[model samples]
Target: MLPIQPSPRRKAIAAWFQDRLAWDSVREFIAHKTVPVHSGTIWYAFGGITLFLFVIQVVTGILLLVYYRPTPSEAYESVQFIVTRVAFGWLIRSIHIWSANLLILSAFVHMISVAFLHAYRKPRELVWLSGIVLLALALGFGFSGYLLPWNTISFFATKVGTDMATFIPWMGSTVGRYLRGGDAVGGATLTRFFGFHVAVLPALTSLFLLFHLGLVQKFGISTPPWVEKRSRGAGTRPPQMPFFPDFFLHELMVWYGALALLGILAAVFPWELGQKADAFASAPAGIRPEWYFLAPFYTLKLIPGHVAGMEGEVVGLLGFGLLAFWWAALPFWGARPDGTVRSKLVTGGAVAFLAYLSTFSLLGYLR
Candidate 1:
């Protein structure tokens, strides 16, 4: 058979795009990029999975926004209309809620994997910082979107969450007012949160996500310390695979699996709209924030009204702040001066932190 060649018209179209978009450089970068191959390589897919879920969130959120009204009077009704009236609206809403939850879960897993692999050491510090910021933004997205349905549970939960913000010492009241848009979770609070969920948070997330991805590309994937040591002892470099087809295709498969899981969950257990929020009604019993916040929520509940002459909530908030700072600064403390990881110490800290979160969150749910 004769060799096939591009038709003149197809060649012209390709040349036109090449001339205008200059995408050749991007292709060149992809062609040259490689990822380390090891047992830990599978952990890299979680980052891509988190990114996939974020894209899912943006798509579903826009679909819901077309019919959603942001005001207190209309918010619940708007959601009800979406699920009840629009075609497949119920599925879309359910997917959005489920994907939001999974996005947070995936982000946490990615962060933990990075920690365990010591991927945050040395030049990748900024990458780690950017990732931590992105995770915080993901949580922000969840918190802001939680109240958009304007249900009884969400309203009380937001009130409780905002009230908790008021224990941050000097800026507590100001931050609380800012979050609530005044004194309480009312009409203005709803509007503010809606704006944040749709606009502000997304914008910030995009910027940070771009920075994070850029750093990842610049640094390339990091092999675990033990893997590098083993490679050195063997007098051979670690094995690697092309990032384009090999890793990218595997990541796509993982995304498809995630999509399948999401569809099954959404179909089997569609998210409930619950009762319309009544600000005057006594809060329904057992009001609590979503699972992501449950650990801190339950911890706060256990604290007495006072601790060592300071408000217990204030003390708890300060403790949380310190813990967050410590975790975020892991890239510094996790490594020794000689560019080696303090493996035992870092692993112990991670285990303890995981234990605390899991134990408290489970107890919070059960109680």
Candidate 2:
């Protein structure tokens, strides 16, 4: 004997919304939208902005690919064609570049905010770990894209970058060789990078993002800084707003705003293609990396040279390996009984170091 369900009128209305219109969930959630006290600040906006920029990158990257030729000979010319002939091509490329910068910026801000507020503790640790992985991949995305223009800067930069890897104690040369796909940075290197920049990395990023977002939802928003003592009723509840309508409306606004900002940047200062990469050309002046890379560049700069028989390069390489190892093992390491305050302090210290290095780099640039 089954219990009687709702009246047919009520069932029809529910079906109409759940099946046809997608607004039913939004309505239900809004009826329960008791705003969290801690989430009403500007810091919360950055995560939304980060997601919006990623969407822009995907769309603009796909558009650029439509005109891009990944071969050695045709690559430069195809990019030139995009610059000159394609409709709003400069705008699209500019948006791609600017959005990438914005994405990195927002992600860093979001991470720092989460760290300061102890949002990465306990159940939320996986989300934080996933974010760190995403950050590394984002850097790789920039590294791979940097070489695509095949210009003097990109060429020398790639050489310097790969050479840095080769400075590792045991596996450096092997890794460098694998990256180059040959004796030096040649056509094969370009082709490999093209696949990495446009394909492999993007696919991985998409997959991780699905898990990252799902984990975030599962854990719910990290309570804002002010919520010192969370009781059962203090945190966000399960019947939250549907991501499709209520949340997505905000997402849509952010996306449009980011696009407009990118448009203005493109119109003001379109990206320039530097001299075509010559294996023999002299290095260009001010050989700084893209903005996002300044932190690592600074890290490599900051580490003191020569520890115990090892050269500065070796020490730096070892330090990088340790950092990456820690990042990979963080889920397990976090499982240990370290206090939340200690974790926050460690994260803060690393961020501060990066900030110090970045400031120095900018001053060096200005000088």
lDDT of 2 by residue, 1-367 (tens): 9998899999888888788878867687555543233444445567778877888888999999999887767777787788889998888887788778878888888776766566677777778888988888888888888788787888887887888888877888898998888879978889889899988999999988998988876666666434544443576442334454565676677668877887788789888877788887788777777776665566676667776877888887777777667645544554446534455545666576567657866754554
- lDDT by residue for model 1 (1-367), tens: 9999999999999899999999899899999899998988999999999999999999999999999999999999999999999999999999999999999999999999999999999989999999999999999899889999999998988898898898887898999999999998999999999999999999999999999999998889999999899999999998889999989999999999999999999999999999999999998888777899999989988999999999898889898899989999999999987789999988999999899999999999989
Model 1: worst 10 consecutive residues (lDDT sum):
283-292
Return the top candidate by TM-score. 1
TM-score of each: 0.97, 0.81
Q: Alpha carbon lDDT of residue 58, candidate 1?
A: 93
Error of 1 at 70 (Å): 0.8
Error of 1 at 323 (Å): 1.1
Best by lDDT: 1
Candidate 1 stretches with Cα past 4 Å from truth are: 1-4
Q: Which residue pairs of candidate 2 clash?
A: none
